[model samples]
Target: MLPFALVASTLNSGLVSASSYKPRASVCNGHAELCDRSYGNVTFIGSHDSYAISATQVAANQDQNITTQLNDGVRMLQVQAHSYDGSIHLCHTSCLLLDGGLFSDYLTEVNTWVVANPNEVLSILIVNSDNLNASMYGAVFETSGLDKVSYAPTKATTSVADWPTLGSMIDSGLRVVTFMDNSADFTTVPYIIDEFSNVVEDAYNAVEDSFPCTANRSTGTPENQLVLTNHYLDQVGSSTSIVTPNKSKLNQTNAETGTGSVGQGASNCFQIYARSPNFILLDFYDAAGLAPFNVAAELNDVSAPTNTVANYTGGDGSTSTSTKSTASTTSTSSSLSGAGPQFKSEMMPLIVAVAVAVMAGSGLMLA
Candidate 1:
């Protein structure tokens, strides 16, 4: 037997060695099987117009705030950028319709989440409605410190197969992937790469309940680019051109399996494209709770998260309390139905000017 001092020293040394031998991360995005999968190959549920959140605001595309959405397992965040008050703002159609505040503030909020959750990989898709320069967006990202964790691609365009795996991104500490729908100058800001160059998107603002899958927008080769299916249902307003989320169909639209369900849309897209959709963007995603996540899990061939958010009662009649229910409860009101802001007599001139600018340049009346 060793002396008392020697025994204590040996135990301490063993503890140090054990502590130093830290195992690498084996799980990513809540799945061990996804660690080895490429980022482009993995399916991520996205919140369309994620910044537009309000209980009473009719044009609001999302119910919960950004933090709530991220906490509930939305891996991708899609926001529309518009010029307002001489700065980039996250607005729905026109700022007069729905102003979500400054883009930098939004980025700062996202950066906070990214720093806190180091292991999670996030994707940000910016719809450059104003076609702002990449430098402008990059400046905001830099100011917010989000650029520190952002992934910069070597080239402007990358084939879906060439993207790095989730494990590699997590290990490197540079995990946030960003894309802009327009004016993504790689030479100026390589982190915010061109979206259409690497992704093909299905037509947005679906008026029909069928939710047909088609490659409506893409500059990259469809076969090699990542597939982004717009899975939200929209209803025509007083005019055929005006459209808003069909809140009445939230249950059926976001169900795992049924007509116009996210599951059906994903399966249809998979069958048509011969590959799984990389991102499925949904409006008011919390309405159906884990249904969208389950659909994504099925597409990725992985188990879905067991936690529940919003008012999702299982088919067996087992009701689970919402992780975040404040905003969702208010969203159920019948008064929440409008494509844009109610016009005011005094604000008409400014609204008309902004509307003309948006419609003439991008024709994005609906997000």
Candidate 2:
């Protein structure tokens, strides 16, 4: 394998950051049914964001976790539009895809939980990961042994649980923001970075203008290859390019030469379709002004953030975090404890080293 550094190349050295889920209240049994009438404000998170818990955290919190936790929360949900006459679209796993490989996952979770000892979480999974090909819009997304999960789109508008839960959240005071379909390519997936970035930019601007709240997204533009992601990671320079399709890319833009890899002007477009579905499940909604190049540096900056922090592991994996739970919540009750203080602790020594590097290499805006 290529060196880790070379394999996962940093698209850029900058970052844009925002978003910290704030749970207004504790969830309860069968609460989704009472979503609209009594739940109050709702937040829906995709299953992918919910589960991806570190094996360690999952082992710790599995004992007393919610029966289900929404991953899309008031943020946004992604919708992918694929047209494969009879063939299947193979892509990375998505948080909201609820298909195949489900029952086993459910069974594993139950089995793991049963064996947990006090202080030992079977997994740090977000309860919402329970969604599979069964409910939660899951569908059969398979071609060969390489199978994937897909939340059913036909009945997406008729969710029996999410809507009410959203209502409940709204009643309780949560502002349901925007819906983000994991995928939104007007025509075809773009092969060029510019084409992909344009689609994402369009989607981002739409969601930002509509909801105005920070969001996690994986909405791609007719992208057969995963381009725009809604979530963030925490690898060394992870957030810099994991998602946030490069509307403000550091590379040269590709001309819509000949038959573009995507749509006529996808290479330059940066938004979603006007007729897409709303994943918000509720109503209401959220942007990056400078596309902060120093996002990560901003968050951990000794000074307050001037731009979005490094969107990396702010929540999406790539960093030490809890599964079934958001790592970078905006505001939660006092009961919620901060995660991985060690990550924060490690920052100082690194900063000291970087300080010396700066003196030797040059000076720059860490933020």
Please name the candidate that would achieve the greatest TM-score relative to the true structure.
Answer: 1
Give one digit per residue, the lDDT tens place, for model 1 in 144-207.
9999999998798988777887877888888999999999998889999899989999999886
**Cα lDDT of all candidates, in order?**
0.74, 0.22
TM-score of each: 0.81, 0.23
lDDT score, residue 356, model 2? 43
Cα displacement (Å) at residue 237, model 1: 1.9
Q: Model 1 clash pairs?
A: none
Candidate whose lDDT is highest: 1
Q: Model 1, residue 120: what's the lDDT?
A: 92
Q: Give the worst 10-residue stretch by lDDT in candidate 1.
A: 1-10
lDDT of 1: 0.74
* lDDT by residue (tens digit), candidate 2, 1-367: 1011211112121111111223333322223222222111111222223222221221111111112222111222222222223322211132112111232333233323222211111111111221221212222212111112111122222221222233333333322212223332222211101222222222222212122222233233232211222221111224221222122211111111222111112212223221111122111000121121112112112122232221122222223212233323322111112253354432443354345445656422111
Q: What is the lDDT for 314 in model 2?
A: 24
Q: Model 1: how far is 263 from its true place, Å?
A: 0.5
